[model samples]
Target: MLKKLLFLFVLAVLCLTFIPQLTKPSSTLVTVFKLTENPAVIVKGAQGSALTVNISFGEKEVEELLGQLTKPYPLLFVDSDWASRFPHLAEEIKKRSVPVALLGVQGQSYETDLNLFAEQLSQFEKIFAARPLWFRTADEEFPSSLLQQLQKAEINALGSTVQWKEGKLPKASKGEIISVSYHSGGRPKISDVKRLMESRTYQSVEDLLFRPTVKTKKIPQ
Candidate 1:
């Protein structure tokens, strides 16, 4: 009897150490960075809710990725830059007029980190016009607002593998340069303009315009 009990305990410990989290996706929104052509992952949650993401984890290539998953979340988390980073994609979602909720993340030890996050979350509240739900630790999981702000304030993008390519540095431009789509791509002399687009300044008004510069060429008539 003693030997059998010890074997069962050992087997349970081994199973716990070796097994992976094979549970299917659940219903929840996630805050994350932008996506690239390489396949992004699905953290998985309930489908068809407002996905107020902080970034687009997988740019436009999410179709194949989403199709492969047993549960494909149709929602776009549009609370912050996650959705707006992809300008065209954001516009498409807006055209559909889908509703989204802004979610914020607080860090662990909110007591030590409350004041700092308060300042950052002030801007988020202005943007969302409501308080955001906070997650204590990235691993802590369950949601709360106090934790959300703390996380955002401390979540620095220092040593991530995601290599951000800054195209044009904003420089002197006419009529308050609206967006990169507002000007041209592949130009190196427009960093400030890039900042404007990145900061969601271009999205304030409805008439933000973009068109290819037309040059008239003289031809024999």
Candidate 2:
């Protein structure tokens, strides 16, 4: 009888220890930088009740857009190639104290040319006085080689869940990242953006990432 009681107790302890392990969900691998072709997948985080905005700065309209914005400025992904041609715009961005990311080379395959990539990176750093924390390709697709380079430089890849298309801004809900770009034929009207800002709270990329209330999820590579 004593032996049987001891055996049952041991069995109960083993079950208690191992049953949860068998039933619990597997831990997911969350990466700081998510590489995906799907934009929705990239912005999968608990965003509370605000929308995040990413503005691709390449044209004069961006300056007007900047003037219209108030507090909680959107992240401006400036085109390094364009900035090299228009230093005045870069200076304007610096003067405003707006947060910025690097919008990779435009109209050229800088990914394949290391020298060109290096030159652009150097030029951007010279103008901004700091390296960019985030980078996005013109088409939002990154080559593995270029991705590796960005990773080595500790730059995170940014993607948008919503985009302005066909001369209209897509209706986006809270917790979405909307990307507006002049190079992509989406010339955001200052009025339209201002209206959206009035309707909803907007957050920068840094705020979206580091917000204590927001919960981040693991996205598969």
Which candidate wins on TM-score? 2
List, residue by residue over 1-221, the lDDT tens digit for candidate 2: 99999999999999999999888865422223333322222443346323333444445676677677676777778877677777777788789887777777532364558566567678789888988767776666655556656666656666666665334545656556777666655565667777666766676665555532222223323
lDDT of each: 0.32, 0.62
Per-candidate TM equals 0.27, 0.66
lDDT of 1 by residue, 1-221 (tens): 99999999999998887664445332232343222122221221121111111232445343332232221222223324444455555555445443333322323434455564455456545554544332112222222334233344332111111112345433423222111111112321234323433432222111111221211111112
Clash number for each model: 33, 0
State candidate 2's TM-score: 0.66
Cα lDDT of candidate 1 equals: 0.32
